[model samples]
Every structure is written in structure tokens, then in C-alpha cells.
Target: MLLNNLTKKFKHWLPLAKSKIEKGASQLENSINNYDPKEIIPSKLIERLNTKLNSLPVYESYYDTLTINVHDYIHQWIINKEQNRKNCLVIKGNCVDNLYNILTSIFSEKSSLSKETIELDYQIFSLENLKQNRRDRLNYLQEKILEIQQQSDKKIILIPDLSYYFSRTIEGLEVLEKLLKLLDEDENKFWIIGCNHWLWLFLVKIYHWDAYIENARDLPLLSQENLQDILLPVLDLVEFDWNDLRRFLVELPNQNEDDHKIISQLQAKYFENLANLSQGCLGTASQLCFYSLRYVKNEETELSNLKINNPQLPDFPSITQSDRYLLFCIGLHGHLNKSDLANILGDDQIYITSQIECLVNLNLIHFLDHQNIAINPLFYSKLTKDLKDNHFLVESD
Candidate 1:
């Protein structure tokens, strides 16, 4: 009886299995017959398309977007400073992108001034140079500024990253104070200082450095429209899969006038979400763009799934109080070498090496060069918030 039951089950399954195989073969035959040469897209072209989709869109500067107000504000500041005979104008922002945008606009060719007038008689002092005696570094910088003042009627001094030189030690603060004093005394020279936001806040609280500058401005957060303006130009570079875009638009109640217009609107919303996710930081937004598109190894699918979502914040591993302090110091300076970090931490190199390796492996921090290491920019905003919430850094208004 058991053998007969087994035989009955096999007989029932056999016909069903055969039917499925026959249907599959018929479909495969139809697919081959219907295949057209035009349907076959070159793999190279597909690869290029995926590359464009994965990459961050380039913008000349923050000015390219609708966020031109910051640019205009700086231009007006320059005009006012020149008219009032003000010597120093400080442009401070938490976002590195904003600070760079302001600096580039000042030096951009769009200026109406003559080539000679627009020329920047500027000198940049790197933090690496300050490894010498602090007193000597201060004196050398002062001497350079004075010499530049004498050479040209308009002297423009630029400190690309001022936070790099700031130190928790008394001597470091003194060097910064002396340098600022010297810059203040020179009424004929124009000083354009770019500082990271965290450092600027710390300076105001600890050193009262704000009193030395004639005027200071913070870059504003970009709006959604502003972000759209910045990203739209780059989207024009590639021909996206319209079928995919159309799938997203299937829910529209009415068929729009032209498919192109409807598709363009949907694309704008995609960019809008990207802008929101990045929280209006151009640098962060650019990095997120790169993270969203991923390549898959499935040969069956032409293009891998493009993930358009906010990147997940890195999960930091267990760290000691000392590790936290070191991270804050690096975040404050924007970047620092092992020697400088060790100096600030008042700890031995061996003590922190393992911790550094752990953080690097977790992608919380990375080496900017052979000697210098800095927090990853993608994690910067989240790290700052974490530090603030944990009462690591003093809260700033």
C-alpha cells in the first residue's frame, strides 16, 4: 500500500514538471526570435551610464546654486570693508564647502576689477610650519605680512585653515593672539581668514578672538531649490533609464502633456530628497551622491540598483575617555598629525596607536597624508552632534 501511494504521488508530479519545462522552452524560443539588435546596448555605454549615476555632480562653487545670497553677502562685505578702510574680514563657517566657496568667489574671474586689481598678494601659513618654536613662527608670519604690505598697495592675507594652528596649551593660544594683534594693527592690509566652525566657536569662548576681527560672517544653509540648481547641471550629463523613471511616475492621476516634462519633475523630487538628507551641506550632499549608487556583480542585470537614500552613520566601537578626547581635538583642528595629537592628548604614541587603528578601521577617521589624520567628512556632522550631546565639547550658541 505504501509503495502504491508513492507511485501515485510521482505520477501526479511528473506531468506538472513536464508541463513547466515545455512552457519555459516555448518562452525561450519566443525571446530569441523577438530579440532585436537595437535592444542590445553596448556594455561600455552602460558602464558609463552607471558611472555617471554613481558619481557626485560637480558645481563650480556654491554660487552656482540658488544659494547666491552668501556669495552676495561676502561681496557686499568686501565693498563695505574697502569703503570703510577696514583691514580684516573673517569668513567663518562650520561647513568647509561654504568657506571654500567664499574664497573661490573672491578669486574667481567673474570679478569686474582689472587683472592687477583682482590679483591676490597672499601667503598661506600651514600648521606643519608651526612645529618650530611658536615665538619664531609668530615673528616670521608678522614679518611676512609687513613685507607684503610694503610691496603692494592692497595686501590680502589668507589663512586657509586657521584651526590647524590652535592649541589647547597656553603657548599655542598666545601665538594665535599675537598673530591676530599684528594683523589688526595693519589698517592698510586686507585679511581674509577662513576658519572651521567648531574652532571658531572654541576660540570665541576660550580666547575671545572675535574682538580682533573687523567683521565676521557665517555661510547660510542651502535650501532645496538651491541644491536642485547645483545638481541639475550634472544630471544633464547622462541619459538615465527613462523606463525606471517612468515607473516612479506611474501613480500620476492624469497623463501629463509631455513625458519629458513629467520625468523632469520626478527627477527634481529625487534631488530634493537628496538635498534634505544631506541637511544642506554641499560637501555632505556630494559625498552622499557617491554613496547612493552602488555597482552589483549580477551579469543578468545591466545596471545595478541605484540606492537613493541617506547614508547610515558609522557605528563607532568601544573607546575610552582618552579616545574621545583625541577625536574631539582632531575634529576641532579639522586635521592633525600623530605628533600634534599626542602633544594635545598628553599621552604616549603607543597608547593611542591601537585606538587610532580601531577608529580608522571603523571608517570614523582616515589619513589625509602620510603624517596627518582627520575625521571622515561624511561622519563629521554626526560626530559633532554626538560630542555635543555627550558633553564632550562646550555647547556654542
Candidate 2:
């Protein structure tokens, strides 16, 4: 019965998704042709992307479709955060607003999802306002999604923002666990999980050592085309020449020396490293390269430090390749077999297997008998406990 239902959903949905992504890529290509990379896009990265997308065939499935509705997860977590004022709710407002707008616009013809016409106060964290206002706002948005999902019979397309949730801490992981549970139960859902800078780093830390190893096993080989597709957008956004940008930074009318020097160093090194990325791996390379140029928090700085000094790490080229593979896995749906892992990670499947062995030894993840990987059993139990203890549905201030 499950197989039959899944077959029906896939047949109905995959073609639709292929069309949407092809449209998105095509639209991006047009945007690049019509505008300058430096002035038009947020990042100076369009030419490289335009080239990559143009090179690839549009009708094929470039990557897996795994849409998990994080808004439901956020709605539940916000309720908990407000209930327990002790822990700071770390979510940024812009991210949540973007998510809400995306959800509402999917079901609209014009794709206008903002509440500009509505009279509700956008700020809900004030001391003077009633708490009910915030709850009401979130509930209203929630209903909008439920209606769309039910009306479309789950044809809702999802492109989740990586910034929507932080997974470095136990609380953040709690949110993801709940999200996975919801996704695990749903059918006919299509999504692309964008694990941008912060989320990428979070995965490196929280996915237990054992689970990480298990995940490393049976991993799909990262396709060159897939790497290019993913990286092109990032390159469009993040690629910048330090020498050129330095002049802009230094000669700006309002600049200070201290800030200028730091920005100069970061930008120079970032551009320098990016120049070495091969044509195939340019997209992921550019994305991570771009993230490094930004003002990373202290935690990120510490993580950077660890990767630099680690002895088991490969040469610069191999390390970046491995990193891109990991990113692809995080965004992809379904699981891989051991042969699949060799394909994605490279011919040196033994080394990849050894790395997985290391992660298992360290207790990051667990191997399921069914050729799939899971978070460690103990971490799974702990995650369950945290979800129950912090579940917004059952909590009261």
C-alpha cells in the first residue's frame, strides 16, 4: 500500500518539480544576461551561474526533492520560547517573514504574500502589546498553509531557508527533530532544503560522530553537474575580487581604518582561495568561500580553527570535495547504499569508509540495518525527551 501511494505521488509530482526548478534556473539565466553581476545581484556571481545552468539539460532531475515544512516546526517552537522566557529565542525575524511570505505566495497567482494591506502590528515582542496578538498572527499564517496543502492536495512547493532555524544547540536540534517527524508522516511533499552557511556549520557540530559515520556510508556520489548547479547560484551571490572590492572599501567616504583593514584581509584571502576552485566544483566552493568572507560569529571562527589543524583531513582539494559532498547529502532526500557512497565521495571508497568508521568510533551517528543511517540511538532518545519537554502544544507559561 505504501509503495503504491508513493509511486502515485512521485509520478504526479516529479515532472511538476522539474518544471519549477527549470523555470527558476531559466529565470536566473535571464536575470544574469539582463544585468551586471556586481551591480544587479546581491553577490557578484551571475556569469558563472548563467554559464552552468545554460550548459545543463533542464528536464532532468538535478537533485532530490525533499520538502519539509519548517514553518510548522517554527510555529511550535515559538510557542515554547514564549512559554519559557528563560532561553532566548534565537530566530531572526526577517527569516520568519520570508518563510511566511513564501508559503502564502505559493498559493497566490501574483505571488504577493506580504500583509501590507492588513492592519496588524508586525512587531509582536513588545512589552506593551498583548501576547495574544503574536499567537493570533502565527495561527493565521498557519491556517494559510493548511488551506494550501489541503486545497492543492499537497502540491505545495517548498524552498526552505537555511537561516530559518539554528541547529548548533540542543534547542535547535529539537526543532529539526520535530520537523523530521512531520515530514516523515506527510506524502507528496516536494522541497529543497537550503543549508546555507550557518546550517552547514551546525550540521558539522550536532550530527553525532556515530551518526555522521553512518551517514557517510551508502552516500551518493556527488555529481559534477549537481555540484555545478548548486554552486552557480552561490558564486553569483558571493564571488567578489578582493583587490577591486578593497578599493571600494578603503576609499569609501565613511570608512574607519580598523574596519577597513579587517575587511581587506578577509576579502583578499577569500577571493584568492576561490580562484583555485575547478570548473566542476565552482558552485559549492564559491558558496562556502562567500560565507567565509562574511562576518562569522565566534562559534564559526572556532570551527574554522578546528578544520585547519585536524591531521586526518586531506589536502586542500580533497577537503573541499568532501565538504561539498556533505552539503549535497544534507540537502538531498532518500538514502544511498555503500556503492552509492563510493560513487559520490570518489573512487577512494575505502578512505571514505574509514572516515565513516572514525565518526562511528566518535559516536556521531548510527547505521540502520536497512542500509540507511540515523542519529545515534542515545541522541535520538535525548531528542525525543527534549521535544516532549519543550513541545509548544503541551506547554503553559
Candidate 3:
């Protein structure tokens, strides 16, 4: 009877023992990515954080906005907008260059017509300057820019994104070659052309593309102060508890007196580390900032409903080998639609479509539109490292 009772207890406890072992193993894996999450943060927290970020007016898409006395990344061009001569600019992409933000900068200059000019041209070229579109905006922009060009001794011609002109396909090669011919021959116009750094490298390898447009300047890497300035608009709009970043409350028995001083120091350190981790990419740093934000929803005290989740580098473990190469290709091109990806990989378009859909669901990739997909900025750094580890060629982040 006693033996029977012991067997029953053992049977009851076995499943619990097994579950604990499995849970421990799961935690071990998480530790490799980030400190074994001290708590299981519900997915809703991130959703809520995103909602709060979107609610802010100035927190527009990835371009650092026109707040804090800032224009877009085109500061030099803005300063020298009137140098009326046959000068040209080639903006080599550093991070995912959002051409729309470039338009916004021109808008900020009170040259709304100039913004329209760029918008129209981009529409004519293709979706994001890559696909086929039958919009009249293209014609309107071309006419407007030319009109402006004829009026001023020197007006700017901005090709916001060169990536839009071609894809990783046979026709794309012909299109880019033609574009090179245009750049070489159009010596009478003041022009500024932008291309993704990865895509630029690929073009250089294939067609010696840079030979046509010499001396492309890279977008500068932002420093801590620069990142802070970029996000100043969000900082004002978003509510975060400065107190949460304070360290060692237990160690500081008389902490109240030094609270302000400590918090100020921590705030500076926060952005400094953020700049380092994001490698000075404004878009990447912005996402990391959002990821670190949490809403406590408290209704008491000055900052009752806020906290800082210490920022950590995203270390996704579930990314597979195929995912790595697909991401590399996207990085190489700056963006790719399903069909574009299919053509490059020589895989069935249907299969390519499903794979990208799965990646989007997993949040490893995001859509620029209904068709074009790009790597999520948050994952770019890790993807770069993973590619290097696998002995794949990767450009600088």
C-alpha cells in the first residue's frame, strides 16, 4: 500500500518536474540574447508603446524631423541652396534613407513647389522610385523642376532615391545604365541624387556606377547629441519618468537631494549608449528608443505612469539561415518587393511571397508599401553581424 502511494506521488510530480526543466532551458537561451528577461513583458506593452509614439505629431516616419531647429539630413544643401551653378551632389545612403523626409526638408525651406517637384518625379519613376506607375504627378514634377530650373540661374534637381529607378532584375540593369548616361551628359544642371549605401556598392561592382558620378558624400553618422537633437520633438511629446533610470536607491539613503543631478547624468549616458548601439543611424536609434519605453498607466505622482526598460541590443535567436541571406539581399538593395526578391534568388515568385509574408509576421521585415519590403532597422545591426559570422559579404551598417 505504501509503495503504491509513493508511485502515485511520483506520477503526479513528473510533469511538473519536466515543465520546470523545459522552462529553465528556455531561459538559458534567452540569456544568450539578453539577460534572461527578468519578467515576461506582454506583447501589448509594445503595441501600446507604438501607439504612444504614433500619437505624437512630429514623430513622423524614420527621418529626423524639422524640430529643434533641424531640417532633414540635407543641411549642407539647405545652406547652399542658392549657389546657382552646375554643382552636383550624390548622397550615399548610410541608414535606410527615407526620400519622403528629404521632401519634408525642402518643404521646411518654404519651397513647397520644390517639394512638389521631387514628389512628382518620384511618382513617375516607380513605386518608391522602383515600380511602374501611370500617375500625372511625374509629368507635373518634371515640368515644374524644369520650369524652376529655367527661372533661377541655378535651382536644385533632387532625385530623392536612386533605388527607385531599378530592381535586381535584367531590366533594372538597362534602366540604371541609361540613368548613368543621363548623369554623365546632364552637365548643365544642379543635381542631388541619393542611393542606399548597400545598393550603391552593388552598382559599383556591376557597372562601375560611381565612375559616372564622382565624389558621393556619405550621410554623417550621428553622435549622442545629434541623436538627442533628432528626437527632441518626441522627447517633448512623449512622457518618460527621468527617475526610473536612477540607479541604487537602496544605496542612497539621502537620495532626494541628489536626485536631479543623478537623473541628468543618467539621461546623457542613455543617449550616449544609444548612439553607440545604433551606430549613429537616426532611424535605428529611434526604434531602439521606442522599444525601451514602457507605459505604467499609473494615475498618481508627477511621473506615475512611466518607466525605462534598460535598452539592450536585439539578439533574435529564431532567425534561420535562409532568413539571413534574404535579409542580406534586402540590405544590398535597400528594399525589394516579393517579385524583385524572387528574380534575384531565382526562386518561384509564389514561394518568395509566402516567405516574406512569414518574415513580416515575425517582425523581422516590414513593408515600405503593399509590395516593397525592407529589413526592420532594429534588426539591421544583428543581421549584419550574423551575415559576417556566416562568411557572407556585408557593407558597413
State the weakest 10-residue window (summed lDDT) of model 3: 65-74
Question: Candidate 2 lDDT, tens digit per residue, 1-110?
Answer: 99997897677555445544554565467556654332223233334544454454421221121111233332333344333211111221111012223322332222
Error of 2 at 385 (Å): 34
lDDT of 1 by residue, 1-397 (tens): 9999789767754644554455456546755875444334444544454355335433333433322433443355356554432565566666335354445444433352334435644444544556533345445555664666466455555665566455666667766776776666654466657787778777777767666664666555666676667655554554445335444443652474577776666666666666676677766665554444433334576555332332333443444455567788887766677876777777657556756765675556787658878777567677777777677867445
Error of 1 at 260 (Å): 2.8
Once fitted onto the true fold, the runs of candidate 1 whose alpha carbons sit more than 4 angstroms away are 1-86, 95-105, 108-154, 164-171, 229-259, 297-320, 395-397
Clashes of 2: 18
Off by over 4 Å in 3: 1-87, 95-99, 103-155, 235-239, 248-259, 295-305, 316-321, 368-371, 388-397
Backbone collisions counted per model:
0, 18, 2
Alpha-carbon RMSD to native, per candidate: 17.3, 23.0, 12.3
Residues 13-80 of candidate 3: C-alpha lDDT, one tens digit per residue = 56445544554565566557754233443556555644554445432332332221122223444454
* lDDT computed for candidate 2: 0.33
